[model samples]
Target: MAASYELKASARDRVGKGAARTLRREGLLPAVIYGDKKPALPITIPLKETTITLHKGGFLTHIGVIDVDGKKHQVIAKDFQLHPVRDDIIHVDFLRVSKGATLTIEIPVHFLNEEDCPGIKKGGVLNIVRHTVEMTVPADNIPESLEIDLAKAQPGDSLHISAVNLPEGCQPTITDRDFTIATIAAPAGMKETDEDETEEEAEGEAE
Candidate 1:
């Protein structure tokens, strides 16, 4: 499930370049939460707080409880803009969600057992084809990340989405085919001995 974070915000009466610029000058970030059949709620969050959360990776996929005027809104960051030159957030858009609503979100993939992977032990390189997978899941059951086990992977092995274990009620959005998630290939500049060893390893695995 996605972890939730709390953010304090205040209602904003105006929305425009002028108002946004003024808010930034005052150390606030202009934002909006809209969805679930409700009117868009224009708000502003403290620049410092926003910056801190932005630094904590995966803020976009994580659920957020935005408190505005003591009212809480369950949201997920849908979009955001960063300053072209400055290291700051300029604007953000959020989508309100109900606990039971299903949503499509891209969740990161975390590979495990690399040290024990047969391919890595034989000097193979891990090539990540998809760092994240888009999945449709219950809003309240979003997994933090999809785990891919590489314990049995060998060189020339291509890991596909079909090999992953998704959480209950979660499935990949791309259903046309079982897409490749990653691959273990022979490293660049392989020597003759390495090539022979890799082939022999593969032959052994086949048996």
Candidate 2:
């Protein structure tokens, strides 16, 4: 499930690069809350607190409540800008989420039972194709990560999106086909030996 947090911000009366810089000088981060058919609200949140939340992980997917001058708004971080040199979060754009709204976000993938996986047990390498899958999920019900079980995975077997059991309303953005997420790949030498064995078997049969 998606986690939630709160942020305290002061309503900003100014907008533009100069105003943003001024806020930064005052140890605050400039931010805006828009979307959901409402006018954009400019605000400034404490730099220290916002930075802590940003580093906590899953900032984009987690729901946040921003209190602007005591007026609270439920929002999700849609975008954030970083300083090219300093690498600090300079600005943030949050989108207001209404009830029953579905959002397109990336959910991280987590692998399980690698030790017991038939492929890994045979020294097969687990090659990850996609680290995160873009999914269309409900705003109120976001999953932290999508898990893949490798207990039965065999060497050279491909794990596809069809293998995951998504949440009730969660759906992958790619609808065309069952995409490959990971693979249990055979080592180069193992593949070569297997090919040679197959060829020798074929030659003996022909004799």
Candidate 3:
């Protein structure tokens, strides 16, 4: 099941830089909802609610039920404007979504059972290259994350995007067959140094 977040908003009568600054000052964030053949609606949501929702893992891809002026709309966070200095959200943009629509989103990847992996036990370092991958899946079947178990991975073993088990109706957007997600590498010292030099040479030649 997909995770859902409830957000309450109210229509904003004023529109301008000054109005937006005022809203932020009053503990509200300005936002606009548009998509699915609906006109864009300007509104304001509580700062606390926005902060909490954004803090959730994979919040941008999570389906949100936004209540504005007593009407509920299903939407996905499309974009946001943040204050450069304060690093706070100053504005938000939400894209309305329908139940039958397929949404493309990036889902976080989690590695499990690392300690039990034979590679780690043999002084191998786990190198994770991709932390997230883009996927196109049903809105209702979106997964919060992708889990990979490395318990039996050996020193020379590698995990690719193709090896990831996705949820029903979910498909990785990447079609490359040889793309690696995680790999086991030799630990610090001579072996590691030699491996790094080899990798650097390979990279230099490729470039």
Q: Among these predicted structures, which one has the highest TM-score?
A: 2
lDDT of 2 by residue, 4-91 (tens): 7899999889999998898899999999999999999999999989899999999988999999989889999988999999999999
Candidate 3 lDDT (Cα, 0 to 1) = 0.86
In model 1, how many backbone clashes occur? 0
Sort by lDDT, best first: 2, 1, 3
Q: Which candidate comes out best when scored by lDDT?
A: 2
Tens digits of per-residue lDDT for model 1 on 1-207? 344688899999998999999999999999999999899999999888878887897777888889999998999998889989985799889899986888888899999999999998888989999999999988888788999999999887999998988899999999999899999987665556678899999999999
TM accuracy, model 2: 0.92
Locate the minimum summed-lDDT window of 10 residues in model 1: 186-195
How close to the true structure is residue 166 of candidate 2, measured as C-alpha lDDT?
92
Give me the runs in candidate 3 sitting further than 4 Å from their true place.
1-3, 188-207
Cα lDDT computed for each candidate against the true fold: 0.89, 0.92, 0.86
Query: Which residue runs does candidate 1 get wrong by more than 4 Å?
Result: 1-3, 188-207
Candidate 1 local Cα displacement, residue 145, angstroms: 0.2
